[model samples]
Target: MTAHVVQRSTAETTLMRQFETEKLSSSPRRADAFGRFIAGGLPTRRVESWHYTDLRAAMRDAAPLAPAPDSGAIEDARAILTDRKRMAAWRIVLVDGRLVAELCDQFPPAVSFSREEPSPVDVDDPMVALNEAMSVEAYVLKVADGARVEGLIEITHISTAKDARSVYSRVAILLGIGASASLIESYLGAGPGVQRNSLAILTLAEGARAKHVVLVEDDAELHIESRLGQLAAGAELNDFVLISGGALTRRQLFHKLIGPEAKITLGGLTLLDGKRRSDTTLQVVHAAEAGTSREYYRAIVDDEAVGTFQGKVIVENAAQKTDGAMKSQAVLLSPRAQMNAKPELEILADDVVCGHGATVGSLDPEQLFYMMTRSLDRDEAESMLLEAFGEEAIRRIEDDVLAEALRRPFWAWLARERVARVGGEGEIHWVESAS
Candidate 1:
């Protein structure tokens, strides 16, 4: 097999040129966004936060921008949102960067909505700039203060491109004080060469409660980058993400505890095989006193797949009594498989407890053998052991249905493992849990 290059390509210059050609009918904010994109270019491994996953080299060969499909089969892909119980809650749907009004439900009557134009962030982020410059539609959702939506709200992003395509999609959510709801977002696709840039900004008012879940399962060849921001005071935010498909994917999440006594919990699961790659990077800020945060991530890597996790927690001087902890574990299924994890904590406040842990290893053969000796076959024993390993972190999922659905891809991957010949397999069978 040819080795995958980890070097930057000429696309940085090419992407800059392509952005210049488009007569950007952008506002000052949008123009600033474009400027930031050009300034930051693409994130590289050299950047401390992006040291594990290098987009400079991974996306260097990406094709030029393409238009969204005029019309193609989009119904089948809609299965990601078919649950009516969940469908009755969301107020927005963006299909390949464009709004799909027909499939979107209604928002609470007390809430107001608008998508006038794209706003610029102060940071010089190339990906953010690209998304702001190229995106055509924006979905904005707001929940009325003191209101409660008992059902789950789902935001489905479907890639309907037939061939090579590029899309920029954006969404903004705001929850009023004392309001409570569950939000679900999914990235689904059915094409060969499609790349997507997506962003979501979420705000929680004082004393509000919100649970957010993201599921990314698109074409194995699709490239995806998503940015999510959360702000709350005395509010609570719980985020859970499950990533199973994508040629290359990264989800960057930022959480700001702006109000005293606010709490946040972040949890996720990643299952990859073959040469697939997924990165879940996060940054949490304890900007207020008595704020607390916890994060845990588990990854199952097989084949020659690569997994990266970069987590950072910043505690401000005024943020006393802050408690933060992050832990990550990866089970490699192949000798060629790779996993990199970095957990960082920066504190200026005394009187706080903060710690992080990271571990990388393969399944223990002794345990496997012991299980098999109990009358179970190799396949059954391996599957059972693997499930037990993942369940440790998966049990944290608040929703049982979501947890079961997250296990489907893993079981399927295990079922496809070559059981006839054990010696023929490499240290980590790309098909088992490692590549």
Candidate 2:
């Protein structure tokens, strides 16, 4: 018998060595996950799910794994979080992907926290498997049964190192039966080549309710955030995400309904400028009877930026009377801007209502002109229109202050730059030339 050995890339070799040095290879779970990753390799454009992002090509060389932030980096994070401190009662901080116990507030009686390894899923995705293999520690958060918490629980992730690096973080949240809470996940950092991978697993017991919000702030680069969740009978989730900056950002979500009368509402808003690229992909499964799901996503792209949204809803034969709908809309602010939307519905059930729709277009000239005629300057009108468009989705958020905070970065960009800069198409002119 002959044995064949596959070759590994420079980054893969470095990571394998790091894994051994860190003694991660000693764990059977991590070893198995790494094996799966080695077999699948990195996802490329050939894979339909990754056709647009092309992560394998985006990352030509693997970066060194980010380590625990030093004292200097901790202070940097504290300064960066000054404004956000008011947004939540308790904040969980992760610097360079390592948890900072001193910065995190004491948990309430309804909540408990622990650290352990994340459970590997059945999927054969390289990113997922890599996260499992690379993750050094995972946070476990549990809510007491029937406990209703009023304040917000915020998880803040910051990367302060200047060198090219990568970090993996894992989080698991369990909502006990009839428990309720508000959770926020915020990602913020600055670097040209820093890469981050995060995996989150959420489980909602019967009658549990949760509102999950994700905020991707400015200066982030090469970020991948994936979420997987299961909902039990009468479970309800109001989930939302707002992305304002990143060189390359990908948000992937998968949600499954395991019991009857499960309801979920999903919304997303992305703002891209310069040459940034952002992709939001999601799938919802209706495996039980009387499940309901709704998804609405919107994006604004400027300059040479690119934005994409891919959403899918599947209704199984056993999921009778299931209701699902998804819609994606984008507005291009420059001629060179690009937006791609793919929304799909799959139904193997006879009695179900499901539909999906997508739209991509430029700002309405007529609407802008009308606003100008009403005494508003062209730039002011444009800003107002953009804010109004974004506010639609923000209005649906469960937290009023959080929604307002999410809008600041978008407006800040508009205020700082020339809104009428010449670009691929629909270029705005600041002054009329004497002809």
Q: Positional deviation of 139 in candidate 2, in angstroms?
A: 0.6
The backbone clash count of each candidate, in order, is 14, 2
TM-score of each model, paired residue for residue: 0.87, 0.92
Worst 10 residues of 2 by lDDT: 426-435
After TM-score superposition, what is the CA distance of residue 331 in candidate 1 from its true location, in Å?
0.5
Stretches of model 2 off by over 4 angstroms after superposition: 1-9, 83-85, 118-120, 417-435
Q: Give the Å shift of residue 12 in candidate 2.
A: 3.5
Angstrom error of the Cα, residue 405, model 2: value is 3.2
Per-residue error at 332 for model 1, in Å? 0.6
**Candidate 1 to truth, TM:** 0.87
**lDDT of prediction 2:** 0.82
lDDT by residue (6-79, candidate 1, tens digit) is 33358666665666676554456556676766565677878776777788877745555655434443464455
